[model samples]
Every structure is written in structure tokens, then in C-alpha cells.
Target: MKLYQTYASPFPTRVRLLIYAKGLEVEIIEPPGFHASTEAKGDYLKINPIGRVPTLVLDDGRAIPESEVICEYLEDAFPEPSLRPADPWGRARMRLLSRMCDFYVVMAMVPLFNLSGRSRRHWTPEAIEAAAGKVAEALGWLEDYIGEDGFAVGGALSQADGAIVPQLVLAVEWIPSLFGTLDPLPRLPKLSAYWRAIQTDSICARLIGETRDAIAGVAAQAKAQAATSGG
Candidate 1:
């Protein structure tokens, strides 16, 4: 099996974490310069027409797109390291948590991704606040789903935890950079404790460390570009 991914991308990172959990030996590939959507279609286009990241190509040559779908496939295909809850209702709640993280938290956070690296002169103050506001609002909803001091679903790291942690990482880091003093974690106790608890897990810690390094590389690249442009 082969998986297409970009190191710093949060969505693809989710799949990477899942792969790590199952100890699956899937080949991970980065996108070739351009996607199928562009005028010039790259090799990745042949398998995934949509040309999105995190497309999983199975052994028989069938390609699976979307982070969530790929993870579901992994769950069904590799059940040994179970990421979903045992009961049906528990599964639904996990899905609900993931859904909220994707639609509510992630969608809002997307706009703010590059805000920290760019000069304030390049972006509107209102735009930054608007996106942050969406995050805070959606995070309030997420608070209802988590416990006071455990994993996203419980002691085990389920799909819900995989889906939500990346978004929280973004908010925890970016909010202070974009807004002078605004912080998300302190306001959300359960969510904050969840972040602290998960850090001790080897899988979470390892992947999160890799992500931080990737994010740092991106910031350095942005700084170099800005310096060159200013010169």
C-alpha cells in the first residue's frame, strides 16, 4: 500500500498517525510538483483524479481518497490495533467528535494557517480575528464531547483523538502568534487536559514532534522568502 502525503499538512498527518498505530507498512509519497487539477497533471493524477493529499493506493491498484475514508478503511482492514470504540453508540460519538473537529475547528483554522508568518501589512486584522472566533466557537462545542482528564473518547486513542489533536495543536500555537494575548487552551479545561494527557503516549509524541519540526521548516522557508522579497 502507498499513501500520498505532505509532511506539514495536518490532514495527511492524521492518516500517518493511524498508520503508525496499526504498524502498517504503507509507502508514503509526497505530491509531484502539481496536482491533476492543475493544467499539467502529475503522476499522482492517474490514481487520484481529485489530486488531493492523503490518497491511499491499495495493493490491487485501487486508490482511496480523503483522510477520514482512508482511516475508516484502515480500521476495517487492520483491526488488531483498534482505533474505534467497541460499541455502536460509542462509535457514533467518536464520529461526531471527529466531524465537529473537521467541520467546525479545522475549516475555520484553514484561513489562519499562514497568518503568523506574514506581515500584518499583508493581512487584515478582521480576517485573523474572524477565523480565530470560529475556532473558539467550535472549540466550545468540542468541550461537551471530551472528559475532564483522559483521551478524546476514553483511555484508548480512538479516531476522535486522531482527528481533533491536530486542530488543537494549531490553535494552541497560532492563537498567540496572530492575536496578541488570546489563548484557546486555558479557556477549555477538558480539552487542555486532554492535550497534556496524550503527550505521554509514544505515538502521539513521536508524530507530534515530527509535525513540529515540519512546521518549523515551513516557518523558516517563509522567513527566507520574506527576507529575499524585502531585499
Candidate 2:
């Protein structure tokens, strides 16, 4: 199997983590999408018309796109140390939490990444503030759902944990001063701890290297730009 991916993509990171956890051996090709280059765009589209990263090309020449679908396929193909739960309710809960992270957390960070020079002008203060608020609300809901439990769903490191860990890492990367901190959302102590724990795990640590520094670079650039614009 050949996995095409980029370092900074949360979606790809999710699949990488799953691969690492399962100890699956496959060829990894870092595509040019990370540098915003067009080289991989054409070639990747031939394999996956959508041109999305984390596209898994199986040994039998089958192409699999989308992170969730890739993870599900892995769970089915390699059932040892299964990530998905056996019971129906457990499976439903894991899927529900995964969707929450996908739609709520990952979707909310899309605007901030568009704050480049030309794009920044279109990023209104109202819109940025609104997106930040939505992120906070979503984090709070996640924290409440987590309570004292160490993991999401049935309180184990199931598919829900694998799905959410990457998105939360991205949230901290794009919005460093936002969720996971004590001041912004005080009720998220458990969630904050969960984030810290995941960071130290071998699979997550290997997948997301020097994450704090990477996030700091982006956040610092954004903060400096905001100060210069006086908006």
C-alpha cells in the first residue's frame, strides 16, 4: 500500500495515527500539497479525482479516499486491537463523536487558515469572532460529554478517540490561545488533560512532531498581522 499525505493535514494525520497504532507497514509518500504546489494535484487526481490528501492506494491497485472511510476500512481489514467497538450502541456513539469532531471542530477552523494577505482582507472581525465562539461552544460540549472519563464513547481508546485527537491538535495549532486552555474554557479540564495525554502517546507523538512549535509559528504570525492592521 502507498499512502500519499502531507505533514500539516489533520485528516491525513488521523489516518497515519491509525496506521501506526495498528503497526501496518506501508510506503508513505509525502505529496507536494503541503507546500501548496500543483505537482501532486494532477497526478493525485488521476488516483483520486477529488485530489485529497491521505489517499491510500492498496496493493491491489484500489484507491481509497477520505479519512473516515480509510479508518473504517483499516478497522475491518485489520481487526486486531480493534478500534471500533463490538456492541451496536458503542459503535453508534463512536461514530457520533467522530462526526462531531469532523463537522464542528474541523469545519470551524477553516476560516482562520484563509487569513493570508488577500484572504485576510475578506476575514471580517465579526466572522472571526463568530467562528471562535463556535469553536468554544463545541469544545465545551465535548468537555461536558467527556466528564471524568479518560476517553470518548465507552471510556476507552476506541475509534472516537482516534477521530477527535487529530482535530483537537489542529484546533490548538490554528487557534493556540483558544480551546484546551484554562482561561477561555474553564470547564474543559478533562478535555485539556486528554489532549496532553494524547500528545505524549507514541503514536500521536510520532504522527504530530513538534506540534507546539508549528502552531506557535502560525499563531504568532497571525497575532503580528492583527496588531499591524489594528483591527
Candidate 3:
């Protein structure tokens, strides 16, 4: 199996975390052509028309596009050291929390990125403040649903942790106030404790490190471009 992924993206990074944590024997690739800049033409585009990262192409030429589905496929294909809970409802709850990261949590950050990019003039500080409020609400929802033992689902690392923690890192970086007023910590008790707990998990720390590296790489490229263009 070959996985086209990049650590810069939360979706693909989560997928990579799953692959690594499970000790799966999949080949990972991220050539320049596989990146968004060269999305117009590539072997990646032939398999995944969307030209998105985290596309998994099977040995028999089967392509799985979405990260959530790709993780699910991995669970079924390589059941040992499973990231999913065995019980039916436990599985459903796990899925619910992961989906919330997509539809609720990260969705709040979309407006901020857009405001700085294409629609800067249209957005104001007031709009950003409102979006930050929404992000807080979404974080509250996750905190409420967090398992009692501190991990997303329990004492073990599930798909929820793989999917959610990368986004949480972005959340704290983008909105520093979410960390709290006096100390840079998660607002809620469960969230605060969970944040500290996941750090000891080497796989989570490694994936988060990948995100930081990718961020630094983008900054270096931007600096080089600005110097060359005298911008």
C-alpha cells in the first residue's frame, strides 16, 4: 500500500499517526508533484481527482480518498493494535468525536484563515472574536464528551485522539487565549489534563513535531520568496 500524505495537513497527519502507531507497512510519499502546487498533473491526480493529501492507493489499484475512511480501512485491514473500540456504541461515540473535529472544531478556524487571505477586507476584529467564541464552544463540546480516563475514548489511543490532537495543537497556536488567561493551558479541566497526557505518547508527539517542521518549512519558503522578489 502507498499513502500520499503531508504533515502540514491535519487530515493526513492524523492518518500518518494511525499508520505509524499501528506499525503498518505502508509506503508514504510526498514529492513536489504530489503537493498542492503541482496538483494540476500527477500520478496522484490520476488516482485521486480531488488532488488532496492522504490518498491511499491499494496494491490492486483501489483508491481511498477521505482520511476518516482510510483510517477505517486500516482498522479492518490491520486489526492488531486497533485504534477503535470493540463495542458497537463505543465505536459510535469515537466516530462522533472525530467527526466533530471536522464539522465543528476546525470549521471555526476556517474563517480566520480566509479573513487573512482572500477576504481580509470583509472580515473585522469583531468577526474574528465571534469565530473565537465559536471555537471555544466547540472545544467545550469536545471536553464534555471526552472519556473519563483522559484519552479521547479511554486509557488507550483511539482514532479520536489521532484525529483530534493535531487540530487541538492548531487551535492553541492560532488562538492563544484559548489556553487560559494566567497560564497557557487548556480552559477546561479534562482538556487541560488530556493535553498533558497525550504528550507522553511518542507517536502523538512525533506527529505534532512533523506539523511544526512543516510550518517552519513554509515560513522559510515565504522568506526566500520575499527576499527574491523584494516584497
Candidate 4:
């Protein structure tokens, strides 16, 4: 099996977290025709018509899109080091957290993403404030649902951790840089504690480092592009 993904994206990063944590043998490759300059097209669209990152292609040639579905497929396909909780309610909790990351957390971050970095000048002060407010509301939801056990769903590392941690890293860096807002995670006690504790896990730490590095790389590229074009 192979996963077509980009390191810069949280959606793909979540799938990667599961791959790394489980020691899966799937090959990781960038989607064809996908880059800062271009969207996924041509060959990539043939494999997964959605033209999105983190598309898993099975050896039998079936394609899976969307991070949540991909993660569930991986967990089911490679069940040795199971990421799902053993109990029914625990599994439900795991799915709920993952869904929150999808529906609430990532959705809130969308506006900030639109207004981030060089795009800030294109947006008004009022627009930026509203975007930041939406982000804060989403963070509040996370604070309410998050467990005290350091993991998202259960006491151990599960699919929930894979789902949420990458987005948290993005929020930690972007909330302050883009919105001039304080680090909201630190203000939310449970989330702050969860963030601090999760980083101690080597896989989590590695993925976090990959995400930060990817963010930096993108920033540098943007700077270079802006300089070249005299923006």
C-alpha cells in the first residue's frame, strides 16, 4: 500500500502519525502534480478523484480518501498494534474526538489559514477578529471534551491522538503569529496539560517536529517568492 501525502498539511499528517505509531510498511510519496504552485491533477486525480492529500492506495488498487476514513482503514488493515480502544464506549470516544478535529477544530482554523501570513493585508481588521474568535470557540470545545489522561480518547495513544495533535501544533504557532492572539492553549488548562504531556511521546514529538519544519519551509518559500516577485 502507498499513501500520497504532503508534510505541510495537518490532514495528511494525522494519517502519518498512525503510520509511524504502528510501524506500517506503506510507502509515503507526494501526490503527483501537487506543489505550492499547482494543485493535484492529471495522474493524481486518476488515483483519487478528490485531488486531496493522504490518499491511501491499496495493493489491490482501491483508493481511500479523507483522513478519518483513511485512519480507520489503516487501523483495520493493520490491527497488530491496535490504535482503537478495546471497549465500545472507548472506541466511540476515539471516533468523537477524531470527528471534532474534522468538523470543529479544522473548520475553525480555515479562516485563519485564509488570512495567514501574506494574506493578512487582503483582510480587514474586523474579519481577522471574527476569524480569531471562531478559533477560540473551537478551542473551548476541545477543552470541554479532552480527557485528563494526556491522550485524546483513552489512557494510551490511540487514533484520537493521531487526529488532534497536528492541529494543536498548528494552532499553537498560527494563533499568535496570524491573529496577534495569545497562545490560547496555555489559557485552556486541560488542553495545555495535554499538549505538554503528549510531546513527551517520541512519535508525537517526531510528528510535531515534522510539522514545525514543514511550516518553516513553507514560510521560507513564501518569503523567497515574495522577494523574487517584489511583492
Candidate 5:
């Protein structure tokens, strides 16, 4: 299988976490263009049509889009070393954490994109405050559900950890850099603890390092491009 992903994107990072945990033999590649506008055209759109990262193409030529759905497919296809809980309630808890990450947490981060990089010209106090507040609320919701044992759901790493890790990591850097706010994690104790504890897991540590490096790489490239263009 071929998985198209960009390391900086939280969505694809979640799927990559699962792939690493399961030791799946999937080829990872970047899409036609790493930018949104570039993704809307050409060969990549033909494959997934959504113009999104982390599209999984099976050997039979079937395409799967959306990170959460892709994670579910991988779990089903490769069940050993399962990332899901064994029981019903446990599975439900995992789903709940994933849902919060996707719906509430990711949604909160969306508005801040306008204020990102050279786009800070769009920043407004109201906009920044609103985004920060929304994310803080989302973090509180996560703290209520996240296990204190370092994993997001069960005693061990699960799909919930995959969902939580990348998004929270992005939130930690994005919010403070954009608005001079405190790192959001420290405000939520369970999540803050999980953030520190989960990194000790080898797969989580590697993926987190990749995500940070990719984000920094993108920022450096953007800065260099801006300098060249005299922006």
C-alpha cells in the first residue's frame, strides 16, 4: 500500500502513528503538491479527490481518504498488536477521545490558520482570543476523559493516543506562537502528564520528533522564500 502524507499535518500523522505501531509495510510519499491549491488539481486529485493528506491506496487500487477512516481500515486489515481496546466500553472510550480530537480540538485550531506564518496580517485580538478559548475548552474536555496512566484511553497505546498526540502537539506550538499565549497543555493536568509520559513510548517519541521537525522545516522554508521575494 502507498500512503501519501505530509509529516506536518496532524491528520496523516495519526495514521502514521498507527502504521508505525503495527509495523505495517506501507510506502510513504508526498502528494503532487504539498499546498492546498496545488492538491486540487493533477494526479493526486484523481486518486483521492478530496485533496487531503494521508490517502491510502491499496494494492487492488482502492483509495481511502480521511485519517480516522484510514486508521480504522488499517486496524481492521492488521489486527495483531491492535491499537484498539479489546472490550466494548473501552473501545467506546477510545472513539470518544478520537472524536473530541477530530471535531472539537481540530475545529478550534482551524481559525488560527489565518494568523499563521506571513498570514499574521489577518490577526485580530478577537480572533486570537476566540481560537485560544475554544481550544482551551477542548483541552479541558480531553483532560476529563484522558487516562492518567499516560495513554489516552487504556493501559497501553491505542487509537486514541494516535489521535491525541499529533493534534495536541500542534496546538501546543501553534497557539503560543500565534498569540503569545501560555502552552495549553500545562493548563490541563492529565493531558500535560500524558504529553510527557507518552513520549517515552518509542513509536510516539519518533513520530513526535518527526512532526516537530517537519513543522520547523516548513517554517524555515517559508521564511527563506519570503526573504527571497522581499516580502
Candidate 6:
């Protein structure tokens, strides 16, 4: 099995964490997607038409795209430690939380990434503000769902929790000024604690290493450029 991934992609980070947790021995291929290299765009697309990173190619030559789907496949293939709960309701809740993170939290971060130095010309003030607001709203929803539980679903470390870590880490790194000091949603003590706890895990530490700073530097430079251009 081979995993094509970019260090900066939250989607890939989720699968990488799952692979580590499952103790899977798959070859890790560094995709050129992170730097917007044409190789990833052209060659990768032959494998995955969407041209997304974190493409998992099985030894049998089957390719899997979409991070959540890849994680689901992994969970099914390797059930030890069981990231997804056994109970049907529990599984549903976990999937719900994962989708919330994907569609709400991750999607909100897309605009900011588009505003990075490499893509700064695409950023607009209106888009940034809209994305920021969506992020805040998504955080509130997560806080409500988490309540006093230590994890997102089943009251334990499950797929839901795993799915959220990379996005939250990215939020803290890219939009620190917005989510760091300010308690945007003060009622989310459990969620806040969960974030802190996940940060200590080695899988996350390894997968997201350096990318956070790199992405932040890109965002900062873009913002500076936008300001200069506007002035």
C-alpha cells in the first residue's frame, strides 16, 4: 500500500494519524500538492481525477480519494483499537461529527488558504470576513456537541475526535489572532481541553509538524501584501 500525502493538508493528516494508530506499514509518498507542483496536478490526477492529496493506493492498484473515506476504509480493514464505535447509534454520531468538521470547520479554512501568499491575489476582504464568521459559528456548534465530554463521540477517542484535530490545529496556527486569546465560545471548556490533549499525541505532532508554521507564514505574508495593495 502507498499513501500519497502533503505535509500541510489536514485531510492527509487525519489519515496519517489513523494509519499510525492502526500500526499500518504503508509506504508514504510525499506528493507535490503542498507546493502546488504541476507533477501532483498532472500525474496524480491519472490516479485521482480530483487531483487531491492523501490518495491511498492499495497494493492491488485500487486508489482511494477523500480523507474521510480513506479513514473509513482503514477502520474497516484494521479493526483493532476500533476508531469507529460498534454501536450503530454511536457510529452515526461519530460520522455526524466527522462530517461537521469536514464541511463546516475544514471548508471554512479553505478561504484562508486561498489567501496564502501563493494564492493571495484571489483573496478579498469580504471573503476573509465571511470565512472567519463561518469558522466562529462552526466552533460554537462543535462546543455545543462536545459539552462536557472529552471526545466528540461515544465519550471516547473515536474517529470523530481524530477527524477534528488537524482542522483545529490549523485554526490555531493560521488564525491565532482570532481563536487563540479570545474565548469566542466560552462554554466549550471540554472542547478546548480536547484540543490541548490531542496536541500532546505523537501522531498529530508528526503529521502536522512544520506545516503549521509554513502555512501561517504564507497567510501572514499574503495579508501584508493585501494591505499594501489596498493602501
Candidate 4: segments with Cα more than 4 A from true spot: 32-35
Model 2 Cα lDDT, one tens digit per residue, 110-220: 665554322345757676677667777777767766524556667556767767776676665546454322233345787888777666666666755734444555456
Worst 10 residues of 3 by lDDT: 176-185
Models sorted by lDDT, best on top:
5, 4, 1, 3, 6, 2
The deviation in Å at residue 121 for candidate 4 is 2.3
Candidate 6 residue 133 C-alpha distance from true site, Å:
1.4
- List the candidates' TM-scores in order: 0.88, 0.80, 0.85, 0.92, 0.93, 0.80
Give the number of the best model, judged by lDDT. 5
What is the C-alpha lDDT profile of model 5 across 66-183, one tens digit per residue? Answer: 9989999999999988999999999999999999998999898887754665455567778888888898999899999999887987789998988888887778875687478778
Least accurate stretch of 10 residues (summed lDDT) in model 2? 177-186
User: How accurate locally, in lDDT, is each candidate?
Assistant: 0.77, 0.69, 0.75, 0.81, 0.84, 0.71
Candidate 1 on 1-231: residue-level lDDT in tens? Answer: 999886676778778878999999999887764311123546878878887777998999899999999999998899878998898887888899988987888787767765655675757778877878888888989988885547777568887877776676677774656465388778888888888988887887776787677666666766676677782
Worst 10 residues of 1 by lDDT: 32-41
- Candidate 2 to truth, TM: 0.80
Higher-lDDT candidate among 2 and 4?
Answer: 4
Q: List the residue pairs that clash in candidate 4.
A: none
Q: Candidate 4 lDDT, tens digit per residue, 83-139?
A: 889999999988888888889888988877766545445668787777777777788
lDDT value, residue 218 of candidate 2: 46
Residue pairs clashing, model 3: none
